[model samples]
Target: MEKVNYKGADLLAHRFEIRVIRHFNNAIEYNAVPFILTEIQKRSDDFFQFPLSNGLLGTTIVDSAVTVTINKNIAYEPRRYFTCAHELCHVLLDTEYIRSHPGIDTEDKNGLPSSKNSSRERRANHFAALVLLPDTILNALMMEKKSKSYIRHQQKVSYETLKYRISDFIQLRFLLSRSMALDIASAFADKDADPLQQKGIYGFWHAAEDENISPLSRQQIAQKNNDLALGLIDPMVFEGCK
Candidate 1:
């Protein structure tokens, strides 16, 4: 939650964003996650990792790859997605500036970067947020479906879902539904009903319970993402992060 040095982070974010844009040339409509990895591969093999531990929280490595374990036996989709993207930020944006830079403690059994001076891990996290929530796409989608119903809406969305995409994500599912939006509306319609589960939209929004903003959490992740670049972190990252 510290104030992020966005000005510096924006410089790096913009630089890399342009790199991705140039690589895509005119095909810039694809997902940024895969695209960033593609570009990283051209220069190195550090974006992807394997042998992830079952209870893994997070890790930042010298190369681009960061290994985070969600669950080996079951699927925890949201956390997995978040971790990979966070690690991606570390790989792409963190830079080493000699005297002014953080040093790697390779001899310390692989914590190369000492997590000080300039925190590469933090930078990567910022990059991950930008990649996952690219402004151009998220804003347009939210604005487009600003009036659609969440529950009644049944359609295949490439990046988001009718299930709990950002709309239901923030509890506006009723206003955005095509028909079945009332499935959960009645649950809350009683006026006595708890606002905990607004249809199936409950899970995603509370995916990170340690810190909740009801509606702003949706937008805050992106904003804090920029904040992390400035050396700040959303509570989730700061809460239990090493």
Candidate 2:
């Protein structure tokens, strides 16, 4: 099968994330991380997780309802959140892709971005990264800190694996020089962004702290989900989704 345009898949993921933010909650000060689970639950009722003694991080099933199964034994805290987000990518963005290729489980050995990734796997990874760090919040932080180093210090992020990921995000968001992104990567010691920060920074839809999670006022979550779903049905563009 031809590889899907990764840029398109990533953009589609971003669109979905924006809907998640707009639909669930839009307050600036409130945390938006819990919405990951909230959005998952909103999409499907039965969500499940278990410890994979094996090295595998997570998996998702799309039978009557989507169910996310995660590795409970992982050492890193951020890894679990990353795994869940990755599986959600498969659920939200790759539903048709999985349907066409049944039983081909989406597995990851640590969920690191790899040069050897298959097309769908690459898309899912990118989707997870973006959902974990929405550009709007990132932009606000970056603009406020004035230096990526300052943001790193304030957030206490120090993941070696994430240096490259942050570089990718900088490249995607600011369209800055690769050298600048590389410069930003060196400030951190050896850690990823805080998943706790993600929870406090992001939020549950309609969580008490969020002033913006009102239901059915004007923003349309269902409509946006329906629209994004059509684009994802056939992610490989030349095969004719357009």
Candidate 3:
């Protein structure tokens, strides 16, 4: 991974995300995804539904109504949750900026700011990840049950499909890519376990053949997330995310 030093602004943005999560009481105490979404909406004065292009995920209009809208094109639950949370960040942190630029659509087509100067979008994405999957919550969940046991109870798929399913679960739960999730699984799974039976902990999934993590794979994961990624509040928020 390229070693891009995190500038002071980036660190401050990260700290801001941490504070936002705290303001919402960590968003995980309710132990329900729907509850988080409900809380977010309750904070808003009004919400709208709009059909947005595939590339564009959402928009927020902060006027007298404090309105927010997300693209209807995002069909999946995980992406929908992330997009909503992203806009909520704007509602919570960027209200002044939005109010000044009323009726202006922050056209973030790729989940980042439209321009290099738009640092708020970066911070919003970071805030969304924290709201959706706080490290503290995941760690506490893991402490209550063995990883393998949880997997076995949560799924009934054949051993052949379990590995991929686990990968999906990790990606959805932690807001990570498949490659990053696999790398995490490779580190968390027990090497001694049978390939088909291995299972991972909170932030990882069981590894299948050729899915093992090596130094090169680790670098790839970091690069995919951007070597200096800000999709997290705490640097150690998710193990193996770096």
Candidate 4:
């Protein structure tokens, strides 16, 4: 996945990203239904769960008080949980948009970015993914050598989400060597242990070539990796989340 440019909604999501993670004690995954319920209750907001059309996931209505409604028809627990988180993003971050729109913001089955969705929908999706799978926790998992299957099961996220999240970080954010990135991504993705090795000599030569990463950046990455291994880095700290 290519790097998404930061937008107004992205900035708003970032503000609460660490807070949401800390609220869950940096757990890889938890029951988002209860978490979101607690959040809405804390704000004196209303929450409802009802059977809805299969194509609809959830909706957030901002009127006298914010009300979030989820479709009980969502069979997959993970998807249901994710929908709750996505709606929570709107309750917390879309105040201005809600005021202007003055109606219910409906979320369809396709919660992620799409031509049919609005920017606010995309922002909500971004917030849910960021809070659920933070960079710090993901890095810690990598340092602990956790497998992709384990992460997917533990994090309650789909394989596609895990792959894209790790790929985006390794390829764009961390700027790791191509072979190394493939190794890390594949390890998490539960693919071949070493996909590059299957390609033989060219793969070996490509892996050998320097990526020309700056010495300072390399040193910083090394330090952070070490800290993650040692469990010294605080996951609560924002550290300019990418």
Candidate 5:
């Protein structure tokens, strides 16, 4: 099965990126999501080590100047950074293609760039995987885990016998809660549903935080999301979702 683009919504996946970059704090750090995003954009040429452009997947034509907006509502900070990177892909790679292949996800043909169901969407997704988990950085991260796993084993990020402790430096600088900061963890662990389906659950969970819900009750949301997806979700593209 294919992963939902989330229109670049899930921020949790970028936890590793945030955690790693924080180690070099004087190099990059931010109190808010937007600042971090802009800093990231500035450092993209250095970190992602990729050339930038406003290309799309033929059908969808998004925009050239991609704006990375930090969602302050989510409880997780890394999730915010992940979202910025995901949108960065669309801005950097999906603008033109979206215009040409516009089809699904179009509320109207008015002015918005259209997309061909999930083609343009899926391609940007592939782009995100390449963006977030580029081979070099991933290897370095894996090594921190003391991972003895070979290339073939690299795919098993979650189950690997190694464990790389989240650096204390990152937690202090980023102001990340330990539970919120660990692992390039996925915000939603739902197995029954795709990322798109689980986004609402994430959004709602964040919303509930501002409400009067008890801490114990909040714990149920994650478990519930997993339960909802357990029978329905199917893994795709990557393993351990990292």
Candidate 6:
């Protein structure tokens, strides 16, 4: 699998955060559906939703007018919200790729593309996480000693997403290894048994692994994540590559 353009994803998510606040009268909470619909309207695009089966989460179609279709069968409101944001990321960020590819960009049950090699899918997932739970908001919550349940309930994101976001923050902010970060995040998220071992959380964290994949070292991962967090890297470096 190709490397995900984390800097580019961060920049796009930050811009969307600004737009959400501006468009919604300084609203910080991103109501994914309404914001997505408003963005589609601004771009003169079309949107649809249907109760799809077979593990389909959403699809982005790029044609005369870009259309986003989401699965209404996602019974969990948080999962539905995440699916909407994930599809919207494709519409807004992957326009050129979608146009060139000329087919459906479908998300699986996990709200990610079934193809593991797709860096676009990974980037979109990261973008969805960042846009929904921005760094500043998460930082403030952490500073206030807010419990993971409180934060998760207030943000309306899944435990899996919350764990990943918290781990990402811990890794970047504290320059810690992935394992260390996950350990800390697990403590914050669930004081009982290890929640990281749970089905979705485990798979989501390691789904990109392959025998041929050379995992980045802790130092490298920390530097990259911190560079993006601290605005030390230019997002344009990833402009045409991703």
Candidate number with greatest lDDT: 6
On a 0 to 1 TM-score scale, where does candidate 1 land against the true structure? 0.40
Best TM-score goes to which candidate? Answer: 6
Sort the candidates on lDDT, descending order.
Answer: 6, 4, 2, 3, 1, 5
- Which regions of candidate 6 are displaced past 4 Å? 1-4, 21-34, 190-242
Compared with the true structure, what per-residue lDDT tens digits does model 6 show for residues 1-242? 55646787788788877776565432334334466556755653777779777799987778777878778788987787787777767877788778777653778886657764478887778888887788776765554445566666666677778778988976765575787677645654664733323322223222212222346675665555444333312334223221
Cα lDDT listed for each candidate: 0.37, 0.51, 0.50, 0.57, 0.35, 0.64
Q: Give the Cα RMSD of candidate 5.
A: 17.7
User: Mind giving the per-residue lDDT tens digits that candidate 3 earns over 4-65?
Assistant: 22343345434544654554543333222454457568878877668866477777777677
Give the higher-TM-score candidate: 2 or 5.
2
> What's the alpha carbon RMSD for model 4?
10.0
Assess every candidate by TM-score.
0.40, 0.59, 0.49, 0.63, 0.32, 0.70
On the 0 to 100 scale, the lDDT of residue 234 in model 3 is 33
Give the Å error, residue 71, model 5. 4.4
* Candidate 2: Cα lDDT at 44: 56
- For model 5, residues 108-221, the per-residue Cα lDDT tens digits are 212122444555454444333433443334434433332222321332222211122222212332233454433222323312334542343333323323233344443564
Candidate 1 worst ten-residue window by lDDT: 104-113
Question: Which ten-residue region of model 4 has the weakest summed lDDT?
Answer: 201-210
Comparing candidate 5 with candidate 6, which one achieves the higher lDDT? 6
